[model samples]
Target: MDFKNSTENNEKVDANYNVVPLREAMCKTERRLRRKIDIFVVPTVMLMYLMCFIDRANIGNARLAGFEKDLKLKGYDYNTVLSIFYVGYILFEIPATMCCKIMGPGWFLPLATVGFGACSIATAFVKTRAQVCAVRFLLGIFEAGLMPGCAYYLSRWYRRAEYSFRLGIFFSTVPLSGAFGGLIASGILKLPHLGSLKGWQMIFAIEGIITVAIGLLAFVTMTDRPETARWLTEEQKELAINRVKSERLAQAVLLDRIDATKLKRGFTNPITLATSFIFFLGNVTVLGISFFLPTIIRTIYPSRTTIDQQLLTVPPYIVGALLLLLISGLSWRFDHRQAFIILTGPTVFAGYAIFLATINANIRYAAVFLSASTAFALGVMSNAQVAANVTSDSARNIALGTNAIFGYCGALLATWTYLPWDSPKYMLGNGINLACAATWTIVGIGAAAWMVYDNKKRDERQAAGMEEIVGLSQLEIQDLEFRHPAWRWKL
Candidate 1:
């Protein structure tokens, strides 16, 4: 008897014993393996992102720790330093995301993490404003790939429907980092024997060390693809690959190929561009609140000491994190993206407006909570909508990268937009935030209307003897005016 035939017989016996078909058996094995892979994916990605947020926002904590006073920073000096990080961040984000496509996340993401961690640690030693700026710029360069790379990476492991919630779970770390950073800073600032190191310096050192450690763990554990994932069975691997392929085909995207022309089409597409602009405005609100909320809290209660102010920072973030998780769960449960965004935008705007107009400390504190919670939901909607609308992997990658770049650009704007000149009340920043929120509301409504109208047209086309055109893939249907003839602008 032939050895190959004998092995086949054994496989058959195994399947019989398992009471499942060969495909089912393979799928079962794969699921078991994939479970282990998820153990790494969920935790490692969250940890990596947590570090990313902490490193970026540690400067906020630094401001409260006399960092400005020690360095004699004056006249938009700190703002310049903060804004420069985004300059480097924007410069490298697209290129870094493209590199991840070429090099794979297992290598690219961890390497970026290590590079940023090194720069973050080095920040502890920076003596002057210029030196701080240089280190932050370098840190941003290394961190550029994180958001897009992680989004792209998750796209590989999960289906499109599952993407938003996971994205929310991962991105929620941004708000959570605010809370964690505050708590950690509160504790670390009180430590002795650090030898002339300020609390901000300790914050950087400690967070950077944790990042480097996690980067090492990611290197050891990250899987590049289902085929390479050791934990998945051969059957499960095929299903994982085919499911994404089918989704891509439905969206008119070529899974294994990058069409530069189509990628450019995504850039010029009205929906894509509008969404990017929306993201830009959204980040203005996000970063403005993240960086300055503490200062605002301190301003409301000026008599409180530094530690008390630091502790005060935790509540808003805690509120934001909880609200994000709640909204993400609802969004995932209902598969309704646009609806949540439209509803939450007004809340965010109202929150800022209330803060701006109110003088009562209680009402002001309530405004902080409201702003954080509503903003968290709005961010989840923004990220999910962008990812869902773009079809091709390459196009989606580019679109997301561009959105992030512009988002950082908005953040850079916020660095100065929320200035010390308007502090204590931050009249200008509050006004800016209100405008941003209103813009988000309008854009979100337009996009949602378009999605609804376009979906209806898709149904109409299906009814009109266009069976072959029933489910055009995202890339295929993107240029509907030219390709589908019957396609109209949805909104």
Candidate 2:
């Protein structure tokens, strides 16, 4: 009848509760629960993110439809417009994602989507460079929450090992957006003028309307947490919460109230900072390609019609999307994340290197496929790595948001990576991206090595009786979070 005593003793029971029959039955139950979670959660988040991405990057597609000419954007005006989005994005990311946790993702994500969707629609009405820049910045503010919010939300439903694949499934929308956006733009452009709207205006208007519709649907569909998931039975709900806590060194509870100490821990955790830097470097390549691929395609197939160029951008992203899912599945299967991230660096390095080495159209075009292969995949790896390494829910939110903050800084730089002056063979942009790829390879290797070394050190300390939690209550020990001796890095 004593609730506190019951919860404390439950941890002790779970430690020894691994009878094979029980384990097998629980595994089967978990599999069913997982399928239900996937069905209810995954597609909704994926569509939300797909719309988020398409709305953000449609400017590139708009450019192909003479957006610059129509708006009288000259000199570095286009780059300025792109760069301003990241200004609001980078500044708002941590705050927005923190709000996602406090307010609950179900409400936070849908509302943010509506804000950005409306911004996208408003973009269709912008008649000048300054107006577009203003709308884009507001769009960034709304979108700032969705990626890290979704990442943090999924981490609640899944165990550390299960997270990367789900993250990959949703994050695969990055490349999928590129592919779909191009096809959408090309198809839209092929249509006759929609009343008074230009091709580019039609692109913004149509994509924005669909985004708002998806946002409205999400409100009816999104479940805030396992405890609140109406589709789940009582037993399944209990199982969902317990399994997540069981992985976190048998922590006492699944969610904790947000606090300053946990927020600071999230910001200062060494793994969080390191993986975030690696993500920052990867974004330089990812966003650079996202914002400028259409222009690059134009250079590659100079004589091709506008629609053909739009169509050409599709293949690289398709290749990237497939690879993103494949690597995520392998990461989940092997329960290894950093090694795959380390491998991606070299693949991207070769990609940028080829871009630098050739003006030969076919070969450089092949390089786009190579570059696209891993830029987006790193997003899944880095986010999952940070989430896995952290312990508490509040800390996970901050860590993922921190990673995203650094990522948008890289995106800000990406806006200028491919300048108009560097057209037809952009050696400058290629060189910068190649350097990022090389640097990411080195950093990834070092971070992985350090994790292995630190785990061994923690083991040695434990063996020496240095990690005594004897006087601590279960809740207090759980409060220690990642600092607890039982906590190990999920490399």
Question: After superposition on all CA atoms, what RMSD does each candidate show versus the true structure?
Answer: 6.0, 3.1
Q: Cα lDDT of model 1 overall?
A: 0.76
What lDDT does the true structure give each of the candidates? 0.76, 0.89
TM-score of 1: 0.87
lDDT of 1 by residue, 347-406 (tens): 778888997897788788888887787686666666666666555677677777777787
Poorest lDDT segment (10 consecutive residues) of candidate 2: 1-10
How would you encode candidate 2's per-residue C-alpha lDDT over 355-435 as one tens digit per residue? 998789999999999999988999999999999888888888899999999888999999999998999899999999999
Over the full model, what C-alpha lDDT does candidate 2 score relative to the true structure? Answer: 0.89
Q: Considering only N, C-alpha and C atoms within 3 Å, which residue pairs clash in candidate 2?
A: none
Clashing pairs in 1: 30-233, 33-231, 250-473, 251-473, 251-474, 252-473, 252-474
Taking all chains together, each candidate's TM-score versus the true structure is 0.87, 0.95
